[model samples]
Target: MLDQIPLEHILLLSAALFTIGILAVITKRHAVVVLMGIELIFNAANLNLVAFSRHDPVLMQGQMFSLFVILVAAAEAAVALAIVLRVYQHFKTANLNQIVTKEG
Candidate 1:
């Protein structure tokens, strides 16, 4: 049943998600929302990797790469959140613009 869907459909969905994630990162002012957008972008890439891996059962490289990406994303999120927390503690706000202006 799952095999009935074409690969193009999955790729298209991944592209859409990636675009939305880009928009979120660009337009959102809050640190947490930007982090969420970054996560979305990572998931979009993961989706593409998994979808491609499904076509090739012999070499699971795509799946392996996706796992590595997930691990890296987790570490990135943790570090980014720690930084955001520290910034919030100092500035009392999560807005990136305010933080930047305050620094200058």
Candidate 2:
């Protein structure tokens, strides 16, 4: 079944996901939305990794790398969200455009 689908199709799907993620990251002002976009980007890369590793049933290097990427992404999300929470607590807003630092 998987053999019937061409590699181009999988690549196209991943590319589309990556594009959407980029657009979200570029256009959205909300910190959570930015984080979601980052997650989407990570997922897109994971999809590409799985698609390319589908052929290598023996070694599965791409799959292993994808797992590592997932771990890294998870850690990034935890730390980033913590920072965002702190920023929100200080500013009382999650909007990136509205966040400003006060300097004396």
Candidate 3:
């Protein structure tokens, strides 16, 4: 017998993951934590895309799009991390709250 779990289950999981990411982005003061939160949100979106792709073999657009999203996320992370490193070197702090002053 085919597994009968409803599509709602996947959507629920995606919602939970998205909520966690939003919470992380809002509550964490560290720049890295915010970056991680952003990544989590992207991952959740990718999960949804893959789940949708599974039901249709002829049209794998969702899967292909997810792959592109993953690649973009990776590149974004690399560039963001490098920028964070530079900021830290100049400011000696990784806290997002501390870096917002115009003086710096």
Candidate 4:
């Protein structure tokens, strides 16, 4: 039943997802939420790359690069979360504004 939709519609959805990610990054102050926003941004970018690759199947570089990006993003998220946890253990708070205070 979903095959009737055009390719342009999929592209538009990707654009909307990207916009939502930007909005999340701008509106959220919590570290975890911001990280989630970054993930959304990465996913949106990957979706766009895949969409472009769909038209030119022979040139697989974009898709390969996007896969690497996804892997790097995963690693970044893991390391970032670990750092955030350490900071929380030391400071007793996860709020970015509080962590940036002079007290350290």
Among these predicted structures, which one has the highest lDDT? 2
The candidate scoring highest on TM-score is: 2
In candidate 1, which residue ranges exceed 4 Å CA deviation?
Answer: 101-104
lDDT of 1: 0.93
Over the stretch 1-104, how does candidate 4's per-residue lDDT look in tens digits? 22356668878888888888898889877888888888988998887787777767788877998999999999999999999899899888877778865774
RMSD of each: 1.8, 1.3, 2.4, 2.6
Segments of candidate 4 deviating more than 4 angstroms: 1-5
Ranking by TM-score: 2, 1, 3, 4
Give the per-residue lDDT of model 1 (tens digit) for 81-103: 99999999999999998985436
Model 4 scores worst on lDDT over the 10 consecutive residues at 1-10
Q: Write one digit per residue (lDDT tens) for candidate 2, span 16-92.
A: 99999999999999999999999999999999998988888789899899999999999999999999999999999
Stretch of 10 with least lDDT, candidate 1:
95-104
Let me know the TM-score candidate 1 reaches against the reference structure: 0.90
Q: Please give the TM-score that candidate 4 achieves against the real structure.
A: 0.86
Clashes of each: 0, 0, 0, 0
> Could you tell me every candidate's TM-score relative to the true structure?
0.90, 0.92, 0.88, 0.86
- Each model's lDDT comes to 0.93, 0.94, 0.89, 0.83
Error of 4 at 75 (Å): 0.9
Kindly report which residue pairs in candidate 2 clash with one another: none
Q: Candidate 3, residues 1-104: lDDT per residue as tens digits? A: 11266668877888888899999999999989999999989989998997777788589988899999999999999999999999999889999888865674
